[model samples]
Target: MVSQVDNVITIARPSETPAPRAWQRPFLKWAGGKYSLLPELDRLIPAGKRLVEPFVGGGSVFINSDKHASFLLADVNADLINLYQMLAIVPEQVLTFARRMFTSLNSERGYGIVREEFNAQRIDSIERAAAFLYLNRHCFNGLIRYNLSGQFNVGFGKYRSPYFPQEEIKTFANMAHNCVFMNAGFQKTLALAGEGDVVYCDPPYEPMPGTAGFTNYAAGGFTWDDQQALARCCVAAHERGARVVISNSTAPRIIELYKGHGFDLHHVSARRAISSKGSTRETATDIVAIL
Candidate 1:
């Protein structure tokens, strides 16, 4: 039976075992990351030949899951995909670069310089990857925001010291060896799913009442049309015999959209971490649609 906390639903499978390695943790600190939801999510994810995540934010699900199947991780953010690709191919180099940033250049001034350089878009792939990681770790609340011109604009978090995810990156690199990274849209990425594949999508959630929206991480933010299009993609993938799982806000429109398509919907309580006011960090209901 599914459990409910307030308006949130929780599904727990008693047979699931604990994760064996520490390396299974996500390498990045993402705002809407599913790290906290991993336990409940474990019950819903089905075993398949390949795991495809169309919106692999912080890769919490991918990093923690069993590695029996290969992975196809894609995101519309080219910088994010490029970082993952580099991590998969040259883990040691990436680790070295990150360590240098953490050890010698982790101050506010250092972060500002790197952020400026990254915004300028004049750096190479490796440097860009390193800067992405650095900014994400050092940025305010791990938020990745962009201006109308597609430049990173989040400010520093001002923490005395932020933890560098060296071990997490190593683990991600090792696991990513059997994975394919793509810088493509969700529809295109979901099209690659076929029979014996499992697809999990965690798109930007619809904003709750009196809360801020965060769909602008990319230049062109996800709109209502994009959400509807995503539903169609999930339905098509399921029709192709792929097990599809999607997570989004428990908005009325979202419920109507997935339910109209005959996808089984579940609810879960999600904590808001990116709000400007601490009082606004209340529990919010989210939906999990399994097709």
Candidate 2:
């Protein structure tokens, strides 16, 4: 059974149609991606005037949900945002560059060369976007990590071959034709979200105690302070009459932080995929807060 928050009445599943439209999927493989939870998210999402996502990692929620009156998608990761912007504006060119890289490179050696060039900043935005896509598809477990200097540092996955989602890219490009992309902090993005909008926050999960959390997706990794700032932002957005939803680890601090903030909280089971040990990769509870 699907988990729900805030006593939401689950919408009945629609009957099958003879020719159902193909659902678009996220083109990037993001850690902590919410693609699997789209159905639950769809139920909570009020019919939107605009959809604002400050942490649009992999864009799983955005791609799976219904098109809003408008969209404001932003992230702190410039390259990721640039990739989406380029896809929306110059998809054919991005696709061409991606195909060339995919056809000409497959081995660890080839990946190393591309990674070096990507880090060197010797290519144009379109080519860099294509390289980023290639690296994400072929990287180890689709983990996007950066070094202290903010360089792409994930190693190759050594797969026999990786499938490039050319059609998915085109689909997303068309879908995001009217969406606005920004490389801004979460607070700045949320500030633009106001009445008649839905804001979904999927910030990096608060790390478990005594463990170095996976916040290195970009420079200046998210900290507990950032988490508190986000909670305040969510409250501000709620006060402004925007529907807000947030996903985070079921950490005690997280539970306590939002408990008295007039938000409904529920726990849902989610898979842990980023673990290096197969034994450690198991289902865990994730908290969902609806305001």
Candidate 3:
């Protein structure tokens, strides 16, 4: 059935929604992260042996939900995947380097130096992963944008003091045992979905009118063609016996795409902190489609 509801909010608290269980917060701050929308998503996600995410932005779904026995988390960003790998492999070492960076390199000049070093790839894998965590906290709005050349190009956030998510990092490290991180695009990742797997997709939202979309989480930005292909892929996975759920902007085209595919769509207001200023922060209309 095709369904659409405006300003629907299932999540308990808009400002701070506590998880049913202990919160497994991700270290990185993402633009369209699912941390706040977990309650609405949980209502839509079906039972499955494995939880698969093709566009695991900040990993809020997998980390928070205990419904799945295992998780297959994949993203197009290699650096992000690398950070997950390092955290899974060497938690203490990552914590050590990240702690040092957070304490010592908290300045705009320091942030610039680290950003250059991160792009240059001069450091080891563990250190590079730690550097990414540092950049995420200090960068403007915690954005991870890359230029056409694949260089991290976000400006420094002039926050008085950026927070160091040590507990969040440790929690992620502890939970990494049950997750398989992949540095792959959504196509490759969604192809792995099958019977008894619940695939949750949080792809970059289709840009709203008069606004340039924030699709540059990696080198090559996601495009309209990519959005169409992703919808097709989700449909294919659903046909293959996997229960699929997707989160995207309530853009006319996006709503039409899911409706045409026979998805059950629920519209909700998602609070976004993309803007640096408090007054500019607003609730955006987003859709949760179950297939």
Using lDDT as the measure, the top candidate is 3
Clashing pairs in 3: none
Which segments of model 2 are wrong by more than 4 Å?
Answer: 1-23, 276-280
Which sections of candidate 1 miss by over 4 Å? 1-23, 209-212, 276-280
lDDT of 1 by residue, 1-291 (tens): 699999999988778786754435688878888887877787788888899999998999988888337999999988899899988887778778877887776778988988989999888888789889988988888898888899999888876788988777777877887789999999999999989999999999877656667799789999989999999998999999999999999778889999999999988887877776778887877889999
- Expressed as tens digits, the lDDT of each residue in 1-291 for candidate 3 is 234469564544346665565456678999888888877877789879999999988988998887899999999999899999999999899989998998888899999999999999899999999999999999998998999999999999977889988888888888899999999999999999999999999999899878898888888888999999998999999889999999999889989988999999998889987888879889888999998
Cα lDDT for residue 180, model 3? 98
Model 1 scores a TM of 0.89
Sorted on lDDT, best first, the list reads: 3, 2, 1
Error of 2 at 233 (Å): 0.9
**Residue 110 CA error for candidate 1 (Å)?**
1.6
Question: What would the per-residue lDDT of candidate 2 be over residues 1-291, giving only the tens digit for each residue?
Answer: 355679875666767677834556788888898876776667677778888999998998787767476788999998899899889889999999998888889989999999999999999999999999999998998899989898999999987878899778877887887689999999999988889999999999998767677887998899999999999999999889899999998778888888867779978878887876668887888888999
lDDT of each candidate versus the true structure: 0.86, 0.87, 0.89
Q: Count the backbone clashes (under 3 Å) in each candidate.
A: 0, 0, 0
Q: In model 2, state the lDDT of residue 184.
A: 98
